[model samples]
Target chain A: MEIFSNLADGFAVALTAQHLLLALLGCFLGTLMGALPGLGPANGVAILIPIAFTLGLGPVASLILLTSVYYGAMYGGRISSILLNIPGDEPAMMTCLDGHPMALHGKAGEALAISGIASFIGSFFATWGLVLIAPQLVKVALLFGPAEYFALFTMAFATLGGVTASNQAKSAFAAALGLGIAMIGSDSQTGSERFTFGHIHLYDGIDFLIAIVGLFAISEVLIFIEHHQGGAAAKSSAKIGKLIPDFCIFKRSIGTLVRSTIIGFLSGVLPGAGASLGSFLSYSVEKNTLDRENKTFGKGDPRGVIAPECGNNAAAGGALVPMLSLGVPGSGTTAVLLAVLLQLNITPGPLLFRNNPDIVWGLIAALFIANFMLLALNLPMVGLFTRVLLIPTRILMPVVAMISFVGIYGLTGSTFDVMLMVGFGFGGWLLRKLGVPLVPVILGILLGNEMEVNLRRALQISDGDWSIMVGSPLAIGIWAIAIAGFVLPIFFGKKVKNQMHADHSEVEMEEVIEGGD
Target chain B: MSDRIFGFFGLALSAFYFWATSIIPDSFMIDVVGPRAFPYIVGTVLAICALYILLRPDAEPDWPNLMNFIEIVFATAVMFLYAWTLSKVGFVIATVFATSYLTWRLGSKPLGSLITGIATSAGIYVVFHLILGLSLAKGPLGF
Candidate 1:
């Protein structure tokens, strides 16, 4: 009854014309942006935050628009992943495994429709789960303190080794580097310049959006110059089959969907776990469940596609749980949300639910609306996103380049930003060459500030006792799970791969981490 | 391995970073955490990665077309100039040159390239400045 009243009030806020229009506009732009290569959702959201701020949007309206865009991007990412074999981000990497092959087999439409419905199921189910499980999850999360946080951070650091495409030590080194960068400007506790090197820009910490754009967006352009021309959607045909997925096919994978949602949502709720993980775990879980069937999982298996799509989308929502209820972001995108909340002077956490019930509940309601709207938007438009290839690369590339430059300039009237974009582009090109995953860098930067704050705060409470991190059972359990997530890979990654192959013939194209994508 | 590229660049960059860090005056409240510690770590990592790459040239992927390198560098130069010129020379002239170079490289017809360069710049001007209400600089056309 209480929940019903809250949701009714939320409907009042969400149903307003202003919020609805913002949601529509956000979804429209997000799909369009995701349709484009070289610009993913995080950068899309980051670049548009200035515009959102300029519009003087209230917290609910701003979150509604931004979150809608997020859902749209998830929907749109499959367009490129299916038709062009370009995963928009790490989460979409799995989609391309089966989706691109399906496209190759003239089942592009089926793949898109399947993945689309799967995304809707994943997102819709997860949103419902959000309303139901969030308060309970928050109740559990409240028991964590700095000792627990420190332990969790350490486990996050450990898990990152498995999370990345490279050696764990290198990923850890990157984390340390990101932490070092976060320690720039001035140490909040010590009141001293750290790495400013006499440049005033160094006085302020690195703007995560700037670094992200540099790393993911600009870097993508630089690398695209090398291999982008050869295969840019060569002769991919569309499916003329049923636009909606057959329920019989879905019947086989409902377990994958439910299990994946649980796994994905849980991963998303954890401080450092992410959508890619949600999808990966979901795929693995589905594979284990189907082991007896001799199901060939990655050879355009519907379950293969279903698991990740469901997991990633559910993870997207689960990621928001921590961001909303705990003020801690479980992933890079949510961390960006945190930064936006901070900029707007909106405190996100348990108090947010209490103080601004409308914003919290309304934003939740908008996500439900977005999930449905994206399904409608995507079903009618899969062909349109694929048709983008009809625009000659000649015109498209230059226009995209011009728009990126113009966007940088318009957002910040500074020449340095453009140069910074180039520098990050170069660095990104090198990282790509080396096969290090780019998502981790963005994840690191997004969480970098929070990790630092939590570390310091933990120490303050424990009076510098490192043992405080796992002092509570909940914290200890998180630490154990995190350690298992990292260590299980060393012993079990190969075994899991072989078991997977023994059961399901075609192995998942070990996600091309470096350059091939 | 052309350590000349890695070695010279690595040593030079780290030297600069080290020198920059060395200048931070020692304080009475010195603790385990300091500004210099992080940079030194990154410099060390960069030096290590550079060394590994330099030592093992065989590990690098089969190089793409050699001419692609030249193209990439040239494009980077074009973008650098675009950044440099956008504010001073104004967006129009800078954009025209950037678009023309990018289009020609991407295999567009010259006439189409020229039209696109001018049209995109104009479209951007109207969309960003006129429509969005952010101030974009007017070129000599002064619209």
Candidate 2:
């Protein structure tokens, strides 16, 4: 009765004409931005946040708009991955393994249909899971103190294997580098400046948006330029014929769809394990199980496409649980979401549910509506979505660059931030060239300050006793998981590596590899 | 090898960071762990990673050829120049020049590239300044 009553109240707020329109717009823009090769949901949300802020949409409506973009981007990412062999974002990388092959075989329509259906199913189930589990999770999260929070953060860092480049050491280095970057501003606890170098701007710290734009958007521009030789245009012959699947394809992939949704949702709930990881894990599990002997995974198998597409959408839904319930963002896009919430002076955590039921339930209800909106937008408009790929890289890249400049400049209103963005752009390009992964760096920067703050808080509470780091069973369990997270990758690294290699080779000759960088 | 170069660079970065950490002014009221301790641990970890990278390189580094390397350097310079001049010249002028130059360098026709630069600058300026009600940098013309 409580859940039903809450759902009714949520619908009362979410189903308003104004809220419905915002959700629709968010979904449409999310898909468009997510379909862009270099700029994914993070960019989509980041660029739009300032606009939303300026629009003065109340907190709920703006969130509805932004979250729809997040969901829309996940669905949109599959379009490029399936049709052009270019993943729109990292999670979509796995979708390319089989999705493109299906496209190449002239079954692009079926592939898109199957993926669309799978995304709907995954997100549908995951949203229900969120509705059921988040309240309980928040209750548990309420029991967490600084010591337990420190342990949880450690667990989060330990599970950061999916973001690694070649080896664990490289990933660790990238993370540490990010942590060091996060330490640039004045210390929150001690009130002493850490690494400001006497500049007044440094006191507030490196803006996350500046770092994100530089690392993702500008570095992408630099890479695009470096690789762009004259007369090399993006060529794709994949056409959308029909947007519906027959019963046979549906029946065969039903199990995979269900299994992958569960895997993806669970993975998304983990602190730092994002949608990409969920996609990778689901694909691997399906590949290792259903097609074990001969491994028909990357050879245009519909299940291959279904598994990751479903998993990633589910994971996107799953990722929202932590951010809503505990105030800990599970991924980059969620981090941006958290930033927006903080900017609005709305602290997202357990207390938020009791204090602000309207916002919380409205968000939950809006997500349900957004899923259907995305399905409607994606299915009927498959042909229109494919048209976005025809835009040339030269034209697309410059637009993205200008947008990055304007977005950052608009947010901070400081040209110094623009320059800082350019500097980070160069740094990002160089780091990518040297084979260092950027995700860990971003995560490190995002979480570093929070981790230190919690750690210091725990230590101070215990009067310098280090044992407080694992003082409770929850802390002990988290540390144990963290250790396991560190160890499991070593044992199963080779299998995952081989599967990734297989995915890379299945496409038509690798022309210009861009995603998963 | 590129790894070695990166490894050494990482080492240098760690050393500089450690030195920087040493100079952070300690608060009079000492806590369990000072502000400098986290950076020191990070520096140490970074140094170890760097040392490992230097000692045992993973993959053979693929350095870009002469032309590509030159293009990269030139591009970096253009970006830096754009950043330096943005506030002084304002958004429209800086964006037009940087984007047009980059577009041209990417092999667009000169005239088309210039048009693109002007179009992009004008389009963004209108959206941010007029539509969004946000103030971009005011140059001499103030538009």
Q: Give me the candidate number with maximum TM-score.
A: 2
Candidates in order, TM-scores: namely 0.82, 0.91
Q: For model 2 chain A, where is the 10-residue window of minimal lDDT? A: A508-517
* Poorly placed runs, candidate 2 (over 4 Å): A54-58, A163-165, A229-238, A271-273, A284-301, A345-347, A507-517, B27-30
| Candidate 1 docking DockQ | 0.32
Clashes of each: 4, 0
Instruction: Report the Cα lDDT for candidate 1.
Output: 0.69
Q: Please write out the lDDT profile of model 1 over residues B1-143, one tens digit for every residue.
A: 33335344555655666676676655555544443544565567545644554454324444457798777777787888888777777888888878887777777678877888898887877777678676554456564
Expressed as tens digits, the lDDT of each residue in A1-517 for candidate 1 is: 6777888788889998989989988887787767666556775676666567555578788889988988787777777777777776667776776677676666777888888888899888788777877776667656767566556555655665444333443354455445555656766555567667778866777766566656655665666666546234435444535566677888877787788878877877665567877877787788778865744666677777888888888888887886777665656567567667765778776668778889888988999888888887788777777676445656666676676666666666778778777776677676566544555565566555566566667666777666776677878887798777666665655564454334232323433432255
Worst 10 residues of 1 chain B by lDDT: B53-62
Global CA lDDT of candidate 2, please?
A: 0.83
For model 2, state the Cα shift of residue A252 in Å. Answer: 5.1
What ranges in model 1 sit over 4 Å off? A1-4, A35-39, A54-56, A81-89, A96-111, A161-164, A228-256, A270-273, A284-305, A327-348, A354-356, A458-517, B1-65, B137-143
Q: What is the DockQ of each candidate?
A: 0.32, 0.62
